[model samples]
Target: MDAFAIQRQLTGIEPLNGSNYTTWRTSVDIMLGFLDYEFVLYEEKPAAITEESSEAVKLLYAKWTKANTIAIRLIRASIGETIRGDIPVFNTAKALQYYYLTQFMSTSYDGSGSVREHIYKICKLVNGLRE
Candidate 1:
C-alpha cells in the first residue's frame, strides 16, 4: 500500500487508554513496521550532523531523524488525552516504547478466572513482545 494509506491505517488504531495497553501496543508496532519506522525503536539515533560530516553520515543522520520524529508522533497520536499527561515526555521513540512496556507489561490471572481468558491475555502479551 501507499504511504498515505498505511498512515491512515496507523491512525485508525484505537487510542490507548490505561486499560488497552496490549492491544494499542500491538497495533502500533505492526503499523510502524509496515511504514518502516520500527527501526526507530531498535536503532539508536545517529549523531547530529555537522558541517564537516561526510555526505553518507549526513544522509544517515537525516534518515534516522525523520524516522524518529514520525515514530514519536505516531506513538503520541495513539495515546488518549486523559492519560497522556501521566506519561513523561520522551524525545526518542525507543524511550517512549520502553517506558510503556515497563509501565504496562505486568499481568496476573487468578486461578479462579477462565482458563481461556487467561491464556488469551498471555498470548497477547507474547505477541506484543514479539513485535
Candidate 2:
C-alpha cells in the first residue's frame, strides 16, 4: 500500500479487547509491515544509531522507534485492562502470550456433576489440548 494509506491504517488502529489479542496483534503486525516498520516483539528497545548517521536517517529511525513504542504501549494498555489482576503493571508481549495460552485455553471448568457439565468439561479439555 501507499504511504498515506498505511499511515491512515496505523492511526486508525484500535485498542485490543480481552478475547481478541491474537487478532489484534496480527493486525498490528500487518500494519507495521505496510509501513516498513519492524514488529519488535519480544525484544528490548532498539538502540539509536551512532553520531555519524545522517539527519534524514536519524529522523527516520526516531520515527520508527516511536511507532514501536506506541505499539507496545497500546498492547499493554488494552490487554492489561482486559486481563485485570492477572497481569502485572510492567507487562510484556511474552506475558500476554502466557496469559492467552493459560487463561483462554484453560479447560478447568468448575461445573458440578451433570450431563451438560460433563460435556463442557470434555470439550474444554479437548480444546485446551488442541490449543
How do the residues 1-131 of candidate 1 rate in per-residue lDDT, one tens digit apiece? Answer: 79789868976799976567778888988888887888888989888889999999998998888888888888888888875666687888777546546645676766877998677556544543444
**1-131 per-residue lDDT for model 2 (tens digits):** 87688667766666554445456667676765665554555455445788898888788677757766665565454443544444444333334445445555554546567877656445433432332
User: How many clashes in each candidate?
Assistant: 0, 0
The alpha-carbon deviation from the true structure for residue 46 of candidate 2, after best TM-score superposition, in angstroms, is 4.8
Predicted structure with the largest TM-score when compared to the true one: 1
Window of ten residues with lowest summed lDDT in model 1: 122-131
Using lDDT as the measure, which candidate wins? 1
What is the Cα-based TM-score of model 2? Answer: 0.39
The pairs that clash in candidate 1 are none
In angstroms, give how far residue 29 of model 1 lies from its true place: 1.0
All candidates' TM-scores? 0.68, 0.39
Candidate 2 — number of clashing residue pairs? 0
TM-score of 1: 0.68
